[model samples]
Target: GYRTLRENDTGLNGALEIPAMRRLLPDLRGKAVLDLGCGFGDFARYARAQGAEQVIALDVSANMIDAARALTDDPAITYRHASIEDCTTAPAAFDLTVSSLALHYIADYPAVVQRVFDSLKPGGTFVFSVEHPVQTAHPVGWVRDADGNRLHWPLDHYQQQGARSTSWFVDGMIKYHRTMETYVNTLLDRGFQLRHLAEPCPPAEVLQARPDLEDTVRRPPMLILVATKPAKRK
Candidate 1:
């Protein structure tokens, strides 16, 4: 699911990302930026275009990193092939570190969030997007309806806190899910102050293009968050 038809590879998630970027860009221009799980470098390039001084795109997937390198050769952007949990980036090196629709894929999300927190300078920003826990908790299996068309069961299922599926696979990969409160608290505990929390409302343009899943466009499909690291104490 994550590797298929997403905003990173194809701008589908841009509906969710563009809005978060619009809201967060004012603070991002001319700052050092890092993109966690950067995919094929879409948002990293987007950050550079929006005026970030430098952008580093990092993801655990080597194939994905190779795909990213092939797409762009800008000097301002660097692509790193490494797991976010294991990167040795200098402490407090970035003005901002962001992940778009990527954090939930990490098995231990809170630890990695802290790692991202530790990577930034004082007051540096970290923004990210993830599938709605509600989407994960109550999954709809495709089946034939009474009219023999299409229908889904268990609408509006909310996971209080859990991982419901492992849809994204490459020889059996593991992933996770977290409630909004679980997510927010992890950042707060790591010294980040919540700045913005967004539930996307995909525009009519997106619906018109992807008519099959207009349902996602009619109601926001994901959540975005922006949090800031406090400057280190003397």
Candidate 2:
């Protein structure tokens, strides 16, 4: 399913989230990188192409790991079948860690944040994207008019936080919902320096080319952020 969506380039990840996350990414040359929830090894391959010395990519799904391995043939990139919740990393082992639209699926946000902090070298960057809280707050599909024209995105249960099930490639896919405040504060509590936060929309040229994405302009669909582990106190 992931390979189908990615190969077709029909998902929002290719059009929006990846661009937004890439803008905030630090230089990868000679850096050690980690990719959490890496699907199809896109980011891992990109990191290696950017000159990263090594990349460790992990995903919970064995199928995804197998697919990634099949798609990749790089000595510097290692794909592991593991869940972010259960995986542990050597302290200060990586110069950068990245997740693209994957964090929202994890229920233990704080624990993951702590692990990412621990896994990064001082001043190392973590860049990730998740479904925007507004989208996650109420994940019911778009409200439509009589002709099935999308009227407006709905919003409710903003304060509620927990697992939300919705149909994606299959039925009953679950994603965790948390407030924007929770996301930022969790990083802050773990001593990460907040560097950038973005609710990005497709650029004008993209919108012109793919008019179907106009609804995304009306309400942001994803949030991308950058946080850095503070350098050890001098």
Candidate 3:
């Protein structure tokens, strides 16, 4: 049902995330790619179209893998049903590793980042997006007037980090919360060289399509990053 459930992302992902990724991603021609937490293989298919020779699309959900496999007939793509935590790949096996909007759901991001670092070839690229720390900093929601007009958003206990349960397409979904420092520092600690960081904004065309999303300017909903695995030293 992710295919049907994703319509709401017209502005957030379609406008912001996708554009940011296209700008950040290095050329993928003939690259061996790993897509961690690949939901329905949309991105994997895109990687193939971008000229990647092989792509492994891994996800924790069996249903999601099934959906991806059904849609992907390309011999270049392989769908694996596995959790990011348990999934394993040989060292220097891939030229690129990418994940989108999936890191927030992972509790042990540090370990997973290390895993990705190990999975990539030296000098390989890693790009991913997660819910912005500002958005994950608290459970607070928009405070609206009696007329249901927006008053203001509230923030509290931002320094506290842990699991947050909120309803979305599914009820009682759990997402992990971490500060931006934790995200950036852990990648550096694990030996990645940071390349780019982005708090993406919807393009004018996106804003024109959905004027209500003007509120995204007040707060960013996502954070995107690009990093590189260091090559072996002489």
Candidate 4:
């Protein structure tokens, strides 16, 4: 379902999230990469194209792994069917670790951040995106006027953080909600130096092509962040 949406290249992920992620990502040349919640292996392929020496792509869904495997031909990119919660990595294994729009689905955000920190080599980078807190704070959809025009986004329960269920391609999909403070502070607590933070809006070209995305400018749907492990002091 995500593959279909992404391949169509018409959704927010393609038009907004992916572009923001690419902008925040560092150079991949000859680096070892780890892609958490790799989905259909899109980032794995992109990393290889950017000259990453190797990529370990992991997804919780076997179907996603199979689809990715079928689409991928690069021997350097390995696909594993494993949940981010359950998967284990050798310490300091990757030069770059990335997760795209998947961390919100995980309940233990702090644990994941800690794991990512431990899995990175000293000075390694971590870049990831998640559903913005505004959207996740209350996934009650939008407020509409009498003519069914979107009036504005409704935000409530921001201070309360925990599980929230909302529909996507399917109904009752669960996602954990965390405040912006929690997200940034978690990385800081885990010894990551914050590099950049972005709540990206669709670019001009994207808005010109998809006028429906005008609401995104008012309230961004995705949050992209970059943090790096501190290099050991000599």
Estimate every model's Cα lDDT from 0 to 1. 0.75, 0.91, 0.88, 0.92
TM-score of 2: 0.96
Best-fitting candidate, measured by lDDT?
Answer: 4
> Tens digit of lDDT per residue, candidate 2, span 98-160?
998789989999999999999999999999999999999999979999999998999999899
lDDT of 3 at 222: 86
Q: Write the per-residue lDDT of candidate 3 for residues 67-181, one digit (tens) a residue.
A: 8999988998999999999989998899999999998989899899989999999999999999998888775667789999768666766788889877666655678889989
lDDT preference between candidates 1 and 2, better one: 2
Considering TM-score, which of the candidate structures 2 and 3 is the better prediction for this target? 2
158 Cα displacement, candidate 2 (Å): 0.7
What C-alpha lDDT does candidate 3 achieve relative to the native structure? Answer: 0.88
TM-score of 4: 0.96
Where model 2 places Cα greater than 4 Å from the true spot, the runs are 9-11
TM-score of 1: 0.82
**Model 1, 130-196: lDDT tens per residue?**
8766655555544567887655434454544555566555545554657778888888888799999
Candidate 4 — which residues are off by over 4 angstroms?
A: none
How do the residues 23-73 of candidate 4 rate in per-residue lDDT, one tens digit apiece? Answer: 888899999999999988989999999999999999998999999999999
Q: What TM-score would every model get versus the actual structure? A: 0.82, 0.96, 0.95, 0.96
Stretches > 4 Å off in candidate 1:
1-4, 7-11, 141-144, 148-162, 204-213, 217-219, 231-234
- Order the candidates by lDDT, highest first: 4, 2, 3, 1
**Native-to-model Cα distance after best TM-score fit, residue 48 in candidate 3, in Å:** 0.5
Model 2: which ten-residue window has the lowest total lDDT? 2-11
